[model samples]
Every structure is written in C-alpha cells, then in structure tokens.
Target: MGGAVSAVAISSILIANRGEIACRIIRTARGLGLRTIAVYSEADRGAPHAVMADEAVMIGPAPVGESYLRSDRIIEAAQATRADAIHPGYGFLSENEAFAEAVDNAGLVFIGPPAKAIYLMGNKAEAKRRMLAAGVPCVPGYEGDDQDDLAFAEAAQDIGYPVMVKAAAGGGGRGMRLVDEAGELADALGLARSEAASAFGSDELILEKAVLRPRHVEIQVFADKHGNFIHLGERDCSVQRRHQKVIEEAPCPVMTEDLRAAMGSAAVDAAKAVDYRGAGTVEFLLDAAGDFYFLEMNTRLQVEHPVTEMITGLDLVAMQIAVAQGEELPLRQDDLKLNGHAIEARLYAEDPSRDYLPATGRIDLWRPAAGEGVRVDAGVATGMEVSPYYDPMLAKVIAWGETRDVARTRLVRALKESALLGPTTNSSFLVDILQRDAFIHGEATTAFLDEFYTGGFVADEPGGADVALAAALLLDDDRDAAFAAAGYVSATQLGWSSAPLSPIPLHLTTDRGVFDIGAECLGAVWSVTVGDDLFAVALGQRTDHAVRARINGRTIDAVAAISGSDIGLSVSGKCFRFHRARPGMEDDAAGSSGRVVAPMPGLVVDILVKKGQKVARGDALAVLEAMKMQHQIAAPIDGVVTGIDASKGDQLASGDLMIDIGDAAE
Candidate 1:
C-alpha cells in the first residue's frame, strides 16, 4: 500500500464509474459533506450520475472502450474539475492497476488499494497460488498454467465430474460453467473458454473443484496503509441463476460465531499477503460440512455491499474515502458486531421463464416500494433506457429485518406491491424463487437455480390465477355480465344488447369457469353467477376503454377492455396475460401474425431482411440492443414481410412495431 501522508480535507472526489455505482458513490460523498464529480459516456449523459454529482464531465462517446475504460480521460476530467481524489466505484477501470498509478502520478489520491496489491491479486491463478502458500484452504483442483484443451480436460477429470471450468479473468458470472458429468466437460470447456475470451480478452482458464452443495459466503475486508485490517462478517450469495448471483444476504444462514471468526481470519490473511488496502471482498465456498475454501478475492467493492452495510451499520464507501486519506480503519475485529439480517434481490430487466435474457426499455412507470425495512439502490428512473452499453441490472432492492426470514418475507411483500409496466423484468422471478418451499426451508446452494426451475411452468402457480382472470373476466365483462347476471329469474336485459343475443356459454379459466346464469339489477346492486358461485356486483364509473366492477364478497378491480366482442384485460404487473389464449377465447391479436413488435426499448443493432422477404418462425429478423447485451428478434411464424418500419442504428423503445410477419399460411 501507498505510504503517503495525507489529511482528510478534499475539495471533491471524481467517480470514474457510471450508472448505479456512480450514483451510489456521489450519494455517500454528499452525506459526508464532500463535493462529488461525475464523469459520463454519451450513453450515460442522462443517467442518474449526470444529475447526482455536484459537477459533471463528458468523458467520451457511448462505448466504454472510448470513455470509462480510458483512464487518461478520467484523470484529465479530475484535473479539469480540480478533484482531489478519484473513486473507481467497481467495474470498468476499478481494479486496473495502471489506472490507479496514473491517478497517483497526476497528484490525486486513488480511493482503493495500492497498484502493487491490485496486480498481486488481480490474476485468478496467481491469487490462488499465493493464498495456498499463505496457509489458506483452497479448493483441491489444478491451478496450472496450461491452455491446451486435452491437458485441461484431463485435469478436470482428475478433479472429478461436477468440477467448474472458470475463466481466470471472469467475473460477474460470465465465462463460467458447471460440469456435472464427464461427457459434458469437453463441450463446456470450449464454450466457457470462448465466452471468457470474448468477454475478458483472456480465454486462459484454471480448473477448480466445484464444492458440492456449497454456499457462496464472502467476507468484506478493509485495510489501511498502516497494516490494519478487519472483516465485516460474511454475505451469503448462494441464490443464483446460471452461476450469476440474483439474491444475497448478510450473516449467512449457516454462519456461526466460530466459523465466522475462522473465515474472517482467513480473509484477513489473504489481504495481508498482498498488503491489500481500501475496500475488497474475500470470497469463500462454505460446504454442507461447515468447512470453507478460499474462492477468489474481488479487488474492488461488490454489488451486494448494501446487505453488509445493513447488518454492520457502516458506510463502506465512507470508510474507503477515509482509508484513502491515510486514516487507519476505525474499528478492530472486537468492535465488529452484526445485528439484524438483510437480503438483497437484483432487479434486472430480464424475463425469468426465458433463459434470463436481459431486457431493454424505457421504464415508463417505475415506482420503488417504500417503508418498513425496504431500501432501493437504483440507477435508472422513468424514461431511462436499460442500454446495451453497460450492465443489465436496474437496481438492488434490499430489505432489513430482525431475522433473515423476516427480510425474505418482507422483500417478497415489497415485490408484490411494486408495479412495473413498460419493460419485462425479473421481479416475478424473484417472487417465485423466494416462495418456493426449498428456499423457505433454508435449502440454498449454487445448484438451486437449475434444481427447482425446470424449463416449464409448475402445474398450479399463483400467476395462473391472474392470467385466468385476465382471460375470463377482464376480456368481456359487459355482454357476459348481462348474461351471467345472478338471481335474475328473467331475461329482460340478458335477452339482447343492441342486437338479438344468446346467453354466452361458459368457458374455463384455469379450472374455474364462467357461466351465463342470468343477471338482475336489484336497485343499485347487481348480481352475477360463475358456475354455482353467486356474487353481488356493482358498477363504478367506467373510464374510456375499461369497465370497473365490484364482485362477490370481495372488491375486484378489473379493467375490462373490449377487443371486438371479446375482452382484453390489461392485467398489470409481470403477468401480462398468457402467450396463448385459453382454448376458444383465442382472438386475432392473441395469435402471433402480421406484426413485428418491439420486445423492449433499445437501439436497433441490425435489420436482417428486406420488406418483401420470406421468413421462418425462428429466423433472425432484427437485433435489439439493451442492458449491455444484444438480443436477436426472431420471426413469429413463417410469412412474408409486409412492412419494415425500422432499420439498423435506429433508437427504439418498447412496443414499437418494427417488422410485420403476416399472411403466408393460416
């Protein structure tokens, strides 16, 4: 670590990152009476960071390669703004040793560890070797420097099946695959290596034994230039999807006082070996036997640091600033105490049922849940696009309670009330995983994602009720209501409506069906029946295109919008009605024909077909760029394109029809 003598007074600190991290750092800096400078790429000019900081600098164009990753431009921004220090708030150039050195050479304090410490722990293979030498327990697998496929496969087999093939430079869960069988190892290796190479610019990987039934528990480590270090307890990150963590909680479900001390000591040892300073995370894999193994150290602050803060009641960013100012860590291991448990769920613009593909769109209606144990750390607000230039994560929703179960349940409740409309999100997926029996019973593991979630839906999910309700009632409440009026004993209004009408036949919603059991207007109150169920109903004032009804013994708010003679209930939340209609209720719009809809809001990457080309159902039609990734838009069914409304390089938002696939075969 740097041995520079410094004082706490700093005019302003420049954040070298963008999005949520930039906003987060600025908020903390403001809290401590420090002025903040935010640098932005063209893509993030309208982002939260642009407004959060006291001063903003336009670094470069949209691509991170030209802006955020360009360390010289960042340092120059700091110099221009008279920023006394720079905080690399994780990702991008956060862990770049040369960036830190450049900041120091330019006479500005770098709010992280020394460049030498970063270099020492930045390499995965080298980090493991150093940890092993420092008496830290590591997974029993080959950490050899071999790139040959045959040699790597042999090492993987030696480690046995169920080993993990990891890219040495991989983070954020990309370029990593789990191999449960020997026959699958070769394919996994090739894919993992290719992805890793593409992502991190280094395909060189190191094989490691995948600890069976292990929980991901990482310790928050902090150090100062004076050799003072302490662990801020552990965070459980076992709730994951495709090896990417979705939910993380503090004071792990299985962590005990004895185990915490041991793991904390090991993390401290790992940091001391490299003279690590500032905020860093020492990750570990805790097996069912209660033993822990060193699982790489993140040289920068982590995404789930909020959960640790909830338990420890410490501002980690503030601590990083103080440490950067040559101040020793204010607390020792004895002073640390973790109270109330906290849990954090990552809100991504991704569809859960679909391979967790990230989504992009304008957050038309964005409202974060408030009150009672809830905290939202978000980057984008309404109208912000989840662009393809950066991470797909929208926010980190955290809930703190007296117990872990309370936190889990509270988060679930918050998610239930939270409404998001414009774009598809993973909110419903979090609800599904949290409501599962396995999660409630504390059966979390790295394999939990694939185990409970099959490629299909469960026989009876609560989401079905909403979909069914959308199908049965919200679709055609008027004509059907006149028919199904209960206790009528007459066909006065039900006999006809403008034209001679027959009683609408009953159709099932889920297993529940609607029937034309007649209707009677008793004074102001009306009665209707669905099967043998009788309900007293009343009509509220109708808005244009929607009818509201009060039904049964409970008040049911249904938006019945008539699409021709049928109905289209705009059921809000993640469940926007089923992809297919229930049997006979199939309408024209329900069928995927003649329209190429915008999947989400994003920039158009490529448009593959001409206006009159023939296409298949799965043909790559257009590429939509969102949330830092490109998603291919495929044709719905075999058809000729009637219209091409969009072209490559066009800026688009959700629901804008770009292509039309229509009229080939009915």
Candidate 2:
C-alpha cells in the first residue's frame, strides 16, 4: 500500500451523489465509525440521504450539470466539510478521471480506483485495446479512433448488420443505439452522436457487433494498491428495457463452475491490466454457444452491485473506502465464497405502459416489503416528491435464497407486496417478469424485453368487488367503525342503501380503460357484480394504511390513496388508478376538439410535424426529453394538424396543449 505499512485511517467521507446509492454509501460509512457528509442538489434537499448524513451540503440547482456533475463544487464541499475522503456513489462524476485527480490534488482520498486507472478504463476504445493486450477476448467490432462517419458505416458493414453504436466515453444505454439493418445506420449514428454529446460531452463513437439475444454477464472485481485482486463471481443482467438493465442476479443461473472460473479469471486480468483498485465490474456478452466476449469495464461501483454483495456477503462500499484508506485486501481469492443466489429488481418512477416514460409526483403512500430474505434499499419516502430533474430509479429490491428459484420467488412476492402510490412505478411489471417461464428457466437474453414485453406487461386488473371495496374505502366516513364492523350483514341493513335508495352508479377510468359498475347491498351481503362475475366483501382490519379484507371468502390485503375524485389502490400485488366519473365527463371537450397535449413534463426536443400536416393515430407528432431519456408524443387520433402550439426547445408541463387537429370525417 502507498501509505503506512501497517494501517491507514479515514475520519470522514463526503458522498458525491444522491438517492439510494448515496444512502447506501452513508450506511456503510456509519457502520465503519466514519462521519458521513452528503451533497445534494436543490431538488434533493429533502431526500432521505440528506437526512441520514451527519453533515449535508447543497451543491447547486436540480440539473446534474449544475450540481452532481460539478466536480469542482463537490471537491470544494469535501474540503469545506473537512472530509478526509470522497465517495462517488456510482453515477454523476464517479467515472471521471479529472474528478479523481482533483480530489487527490486537494489532499482528499478518492474512494475509487486511481485516476490513471479510471482514465485508462473510461475510454471504451482504449479499454478494449488494453483488454485485448491482456489476452481477454473482446466483442468483434471496430474501436478505431477515426472521426469519419463513413468510416463507421464501413466498419459496421464488415462487422455485419445488427451493430451497436455506442459513445466511447460513457455507458448506461445513453448515447447508445442498436442498428439492425444497413438502411437504419445513418439515423442511428446521428441520434447516438447527438445524445452522446449531450450526456457525456463526447461525440466519439465505437461500433460493436451486437451479440444477438445474448445474456449480459458481468464479474465484480475488487483490487487493492497492494497488488492483490479477487473476483466475486458474476451477475446476470440479461433482463433489460431500452438497453438498460432492469433486473440483475448474482451467480448467473446458467453459469457452470468451469465457466465461472474462466470468466472470473478474465475479469481479474482485465482489472489488473489497468492497475485497477476499489470496486469495478467487467461486463461480458455470453452467447448461446457458451462463449463470452468482453463488453466493457465499469471503473466504479455498479448499480447492480447489491446483488453481488448479497451473494458474497460483502459490503462493496465499505471495501471501496477501506481500499482508499490504503488498507490491504481484506480477503484473498481462495478465502471468499459465494453462498447463495440473489436477485435485485430496480424500482423506477416511470410508467411502463407509456413507453416507460419517466413519472414525477409526490409519493403519498410508501409501504415497502418487509420479511425474511427481502431487502429494500429505497431513496424516497412517503410524501416525498419524485422530481423529473434526475434519474427515475427510486430504489432497488433485493432478495436472497439458497437457490435461483427460491430467490426468484421471494423477489416476486416482495415486489407484489411493496406499495408505492402517487407516482406510477414498475413494481407490477417486475413481478410479471419474475413469473416469465423464460426467466424462471434461466434462458432470458438481452432481447427478452423487446421480444416478449414490447407492448408492456399489463398486470391483472382489479375485479369489480375490488373496485367496490376501493370506492368504499375512499368514501368511508368512519375507518374505525368500518373495521369494527367486520362481519357479514344482511343487504337490507348493510347501510350502503336502504328503503327506496338506489344503488350508486360509478364510472372508473384507469390506464387499462374505463370500468362502469353499479354497487349495492344485496339481501344478505354487500355485493358487487361486473359483467358475469359477482363478489361479496367484508372489511376485516385496518392496519396502518392497508386493509385486510375478505372478498368472496378469500382474505387479501390492499391499500388505497384518495385524491379528490381519484383513487389509487393496490390489490394482490397489482397497482390501479381509478378516477370517479363526473357528470358529462366521458366526452372531454378539449379531447373531442382534437387538442392533443404533452403527456408529461419535458423539453420539446423535436417537432416531427407542422401545421396542416395530416397524420394517423400513433403517428409521431413530436419528441420530448424527460428524465434523461426521450419520449415520442404521438397523435391520439387520425386528423389534420390545424395548429402547433408548442415549438422545439419549449419546456412543457404535463397535459400542456401541444397541437390541434381538425379532421374531415370521423
């Protein structure tokens, strides 16, 4: 080690990030008896991490460019706080070599790899060349430093169709595009370059042969300045959406003992080539032929590091801090062992049904799953606002078990039971993914989401009785009395209706469409019927925000949040939003008048159509940039564009009118 020959010490650490990862690093730092400092943007002032830290500092505005990405400000914060070290939690400037060098220059420890190592591995082209020199097999593609677009096009042709155009300076599916055919190469190149410049400040591109339907496997490698290195097996991140990993699991289900050893050795070699230290991941593409190709090296902690930690019983953050303190490797390669299977699902504040567009709103009800083998690392709490200024990921739900099936089962159950209201989330879709036969059978590929879940996985809709129960809960005058009266009563005296009173008619609208139902008390019970299905409900107990109710002789748990005429409810692991119908609400005037609005709050990136343009339903009208991703706003109906109210570069709020369309005939 570089410092004392025996042991070094760190008194305080400033975490240069926000959200769950920041909280994660703080917890480990606290456990090690080190004072933790937290840095936040204006939007994250009230975030959970800020509250958990011993000292908190405001960096700048909500945008990352003004805050988290400001390395000089972060280092200044560390210096002002008298922090001995800085821990960059995965994102922001975690992989920036300049930031590491700045911290070092400021006499502060950078709790990650050396600046030289980061610089060597941060450039995708240079990293691939180093990996190849180290005898690691890389994906077949061109990583030349040529700036010519025609050169890239020619390189793609040689690499074959279905190539991945990626920004050489960054990862996380940003500035990355998958070109499937020769004709789509130009547009893909243009968009990828634009996004790369915007996100990573780099327009350099690299072409890789897209490993068709391959599983994304990555090895967690830890090294020390003492020249000691060890691999913590591998994680399978095959389940993805929009080229980003959605779910990750350790001890990849299909990995045999021999294969694991081979990949682990290669990962160690890759790490050693750059003289890496701290926590890093070497990603690979495992093909169906049982062969693997190096993808890239992440020179900092990974988003999926929790899965590796769970399976190996190690705190990666603690390890990173220790390595920074000039401590030797805590455990040798032979001393470590993988004990169990672990799976982690990322909980995002986004609506999967709407092309996974990011969502922003207050979290009214936050009930996370709690039980054996289930762990939730969440960033937001009840009444917290999920802003659109940052990434939409709110938490990571990790489950551990002795077997892959057991881990999968626990993760599914945990996801179903966890309830997050107000902003839309992907909790339900994660459960559906866990239940997929391909995933359960350990055959899922990187193309799994595109192949089977392209239309978005729809969770089971609530039954009529569930809706009735929800409405009753939302409209209930006495929660205590309703729970107190926990038995079946005669319909005539159920109190919902009496004498000449008629049953209430309700029109419930949700993302799945509208549901119309009539609810009333029958002769012997409070019954609800939809189409041909009938149900009887009895309220049992109200605990916290959840209600244990018996519906048709089966007991189930549910939670609800009421806001004016809308009710957001969770039943049997499914999330639903029901808006009570108002008089004449079915025929909305603005919608009928052909006024199409922006579906969310975002920056208008591109306007695809102009005034007087004819378009069909589902035709692209404009593109909006939100939550660091782009979403296409499409036409809701086939009509002529009579007016374009919004222009490029305009910042829009949700439901802001964007276009007006007038048609000839319906």
- Model 1 alpha-carbon drift over 4 Å, by segment: 1-4, 456-553, 556-666
lDDT value, residue 233 of candidate 2: 92
What is the TM-score of candidate 2? 0.92
**How many residue pairs collide in each prediction?**
8, 1
Which digits, one per residue and each the tens of the lDDT, describe model 1 over residues 155-220? 977888778888787577766878888888886776677666645667878888888878999999
Best by TM-score: 2
With a 3 Å backbone cut-off (N, CA, C), the pairs that clash in candidate 2 are 491-523
What lDDT would each prediction earn against the true structure? 0.75, 0.84
Off by over 4 Å in 2: 1-8, 478-505, 517-535, 587-594, 664-666
Query: How does residue 356 of candidate 1 score in lDDT?
Result: 65
